[model samples]
Target: MIEFVLNGRPQKLDQVDPNLSILEWLRTKMRLTGTKEGCASGDCGACTVIIGTPDQSGKFQHEAVNSCISLIGSLHGKQLITIEAFRQEPGHPVQQTMMEQHGAQCGFCTPGIVMSLVALHASGQPDASSERAILEALSGNLCRCTGYRPIVAAGREALVQAWSPDDETHPAACLVQEKRALEATLSTGVGLSLPDGPRYDAPQTLDELRKLRGRFPEARLIAGGTDLALEITQQLKTLEHMISVERIPELSGCRVEGDELVIGAATTYRRFHRPISDRWPAFDGMLSRLGSLQIRNRGTVGGNIGNASPIGDMPPPLIALGATLVLDGPDGERRLPLEAFFLGYRKTDLQPGEFIHSVRVPMAQPGQRLFIYKVSKRLDDDISAVLGAFQLTLDGNEVVACRLAFGGMAATPARALAAETALCGQPWTEASVARAIAALASDFQPLSDVRASAGYRLQVAGNLLRRALLASDPRHNDEPMLVTDYA
Candidate 1:
């Protein structure tokens, strides 16, 4: 049985298909059809919903998530709020402000927009007035009919003026309290056994997960399912036997150990963003635009590396930052440099049954400067065409040392050794920058894929290094270059 709190009610599902999507379950089984299915594959923002879960402090936190591709099994122990609940409630700030701002045109994406706004408002972060904050909050939601101006206005209004004195008595809040009372209702103490002969195991400890992996080496291991679930929705594949390590308490925590950050493999970007970005400000900026709030809410940095996508944004920065990955299996734990984890296209150094347990990153030391550039067709919530990460240390006017890594340039996210060699020990000047840029040709022979051409990738890699050099120049505090504004 799958149990969760749905709009102040304890909802349970018996004999449910383990592969059924959350969107399908909500629209078909529950007969609550307010959530639209604009895109079946997690894009288009038509199927966004709010998920409330207990934070580390045991406080309930609301997050907007894409339900179209999210599996029903993923919502097993959380509070789910839909547009229907908001509609029934009298003058919820999101609904009232959306109406006052005239934020709905065709009304197809309005529910998702309102729900995403509600999540942002409920996040305890101050109502976002900044354009970037609003954009980051609504990045997952797309409205073709209602231009973003009104939607952003509504979001501001919801934050600024939408709350009522009676809101404490609202259904959602009552549901929160109810969910707290029913916290032990989750059947997590035992491994889940489906009636259809498929099983989904949720392990709460590293030893339990290790034993499970040792037992079922063939079982598909899942953390966030942000990428693995795509195999089901896009390629039409069924993950029969699965082990989910998301519930493991240790694997979902991040901490500062000495000068390095030890982040659990299952730690979401949202949880590690502040500590990580605090160490690397440029990295922080790239993360804000990495994906929509929904994607960031669940997407894990360790998962991104484990997925081994050449175009993933996280790997490039991790590689450039001299990060290491910890992999554990029946053979016990082994550590490897981040770059060595990727061997070829879609291939990794991970042995059978070995899964990534955690990632360790050395914090930025003094005189060390970092720059990350993500070149995507869209400014936010899009895949990267060319991503670059550079970590440099300068000695007066000389380039004492540097590390340059580029994604979407080769079969794997590899460092530009030739470029790094050319820049090291050279004077930090335009001449040295030009030489380093020229050496980029020898570093990579990129492919002409849909995202970018070989020549385009080569050129962008060099251009990104040039921008890094310019941005690192402390002689002037000039603004960094914007790829969108490039003529």
Candidate 2:
């Protein structure tokens, strides 16, 4: 049995097929079709919906989630708010603002855009940085018809006219309480059955997850469905057994441990965004552009490392930061350095029955600089051409140590060993940067693909390294050295 709240109402699913995506379940099962499915894959944000979960502090935090690729079973014990549930009457404050600002056209994408705004409003980050914040929040949603001027205006207006605490509110609070009670009543602590041969299980504890996996060794351990959902929707493959790690409290927190930041395997990218972006401001911009906001809310760092995709975005930075991964298996737990974890393309040192439990990133020392860059065709909703990450420790006038890692330039997101070797002990100068660029070819033979030609990738990867060097130099002007104006 699986229980959750849908649009301010208690909901239950017993014989519902677990393999069905929330988008499918909403349209077919529940007859709630406000959430559109533009791209069955995770790219388009037409299926965006607001999901409210209890944070570590036990407060309800709402974030926009992609419903098309999201598994229905994953919605257990959470509050799901759809566009239809937002206002009691025809016009909510947000809806009225969008109307007043003329933000809607090709209304299919409006629901998603509105939900993203709802999430931003609920986040309580304030509107001091409203335009950039709204742009970043709505970046996942695409509105080809509208040039985004009115939508941005609407977002700003909504922020300006947001309701105070004393204003009359919707009845979602009562519904939330009632739904929580319903979930408690249906607490069987087991898996849900789906159509076809596949079975879906969500375990709340490590022992329970281990036992479930032990019973079904072929079962796939799913953290974020970002990658695995493609197996179902695109490939049309049915999983016999899937165990979601989202409910495991032990595997879902980011905490600090003596000079290291330990991130749980099940922690979503959204959960890590603030703290991580705060430490590395460049990452703040990258995090917003990582994918659609839906992907970040649903995807996890563990899923990225566990999948071991050559073009995976996070691995290069984590490897450059000297991170380590902890794996939990039936035998016990073991730790391995991130650099040593990847064995080959689509391969890792992870053994059968061994799952990634957490990743530990060592804190950087004083004067150490970390730079990450991703080159792609478009800034939003595109795969990387060549992604590079570098960590440099400067000894006054000399380079003490340098770690360089790149994705899409090799079979795996591995360190550019030869390039790092060239940069170490050399002065941080243009001559040293050129030597590192020349050594890139020795480290990896990049392939030509739809994203980029072989020569272009090599050139961009080299340029990224040089950009890192320039960005780190104190003598360089902090003012915008590079600027472009668009009509």
Candidate 3:
């Protein structure tokens, strides 16, 4: 049986569909219709909910996630707080301000918006009230009638007068105690299996995961289920058997090992953000635009790489950084470069019964410079049309070494070998940049797709190279170069 705390009460389920989503269970089975579903594909935030997991101190750390795409089986040993939880003796501060500021009209999106704000307020982060922070927090939520002006105002005010779980009598405190008890009762490697339906297995240790993978070679491996869930929700594909690697301690978290940043394969993007941005400051804007805050809370870097989509955003940057992966299987572990992992469109080099264990990124040297750019239709919560990542190390004004990688420009996220060769040993100037831009024609012949035409993709790729050159030039030292700088 799977156990969790729902609305400060313990909930246990022994027989449930493994492919069921949290949103479906809440609105259908539990008859809690407060959480509405607008875009079942996880684009619209009408199904937003707060997931609270106990931190080291036994206090809950809350994060907003999309209930529509998150599997119900993934909620084991955690607290699921839906919109119904806010209907207490005293309403939440966000609800009060939202009412006072007229932040709802038609009220279809209000529940999700309020839940997002509640998670932000409950976080107690110092910058949660800032204008940029508030806007980012609500990026996933779409309000057609009420507009964002009043909703933003409500968020700002609510943050100033927000209430936190401070004492023992608080409802959150009781939920925390209940969560601790539930976690203690959960056995390691707890999973859900239905005789007539699908099967979900969660392994807690590396050995357990390896053994499961060897036993069930046909089972799909899942982490955050951000991408895999779409098959079930959108395409109506039934994943009969699945193994979850998120609970494996050896496959989660990040650490600095000597001169490299070693990150577990199951580490969520939200957890890897700080460490990566700290090492390569150019990644801050691109990483934030990878998806909305809700997606990042549940999406993992390993999943992004494993998907092997030609236009996947993370691979381009990671390839330019010369990152490597550690894959674990029945025969033990093997290491491979990130670029070599992809063989073709939607194809990877992963063997049967093998899974990505971790990723290692080398630290930048003193004179090394990195530039990353994402070109998309929308600035936020959109897929990339072209993502360019360039890394260069110069000896004075001459380029000693360089790596140029582009996505959405080829069958796979591959390096522009022809362009990199043109830039190597050349002076860092507009003239040399033009040569590299010309070489791009030889490097890639991107295909036309719904996101962009082939000509547009090629043009954007060249322009991005020029932008990188300008960013590294001394003449443009005072100019704002990065997307985050303008924001």
Best by TM-score: 3
lDDT of 2 by residue, 94-183 (tens): 677788888998799998898888777767686623798888788789887964998888888877654443344632332233333544
Give me the displacement of residue 186 in model 2, in angstroms.
8.9
lDDT of 1 at 109: 89
List of clashing residue pairs for candidate 3: none
Worst 10 residues of 1 by lDDT: 478-487
Clashes of each: 0, 1, 0
**C-alpha lDDT of candidate 2 relative to the true structure:** 0.79
Q: Which TM-score value belongs to model 2?
A: 0.93
- lDDT of the structure predicted as candidate 3: 0.87
lDDT of 1 by residue, 1-487 (tens): 5677787677777656666778888999888888998867666778888887766566677888888777777766778888887666574677887888988899988888888877777666654655667778888888887578988887786776434324676534532544455467553543455676767777667888888888888888776677887887788887888788787787887898999999999988898988888888877778877777788888887679888999988998889899999999889999999999999998999887899989999998878888888888777688888899988898887889898999999989999999999999998888998999999999999999787878888988888887876776677553432454222
Local distance difference test, per candidate?
0.80, 0.79, 0.87
Which 10-residue window of candidate 3 scores lowest in summed lDDT? 478-487
Residue-level lDDT for 80 in candidate 3: 92
Model 2 poorest ten-residue lDDT run? 478-487
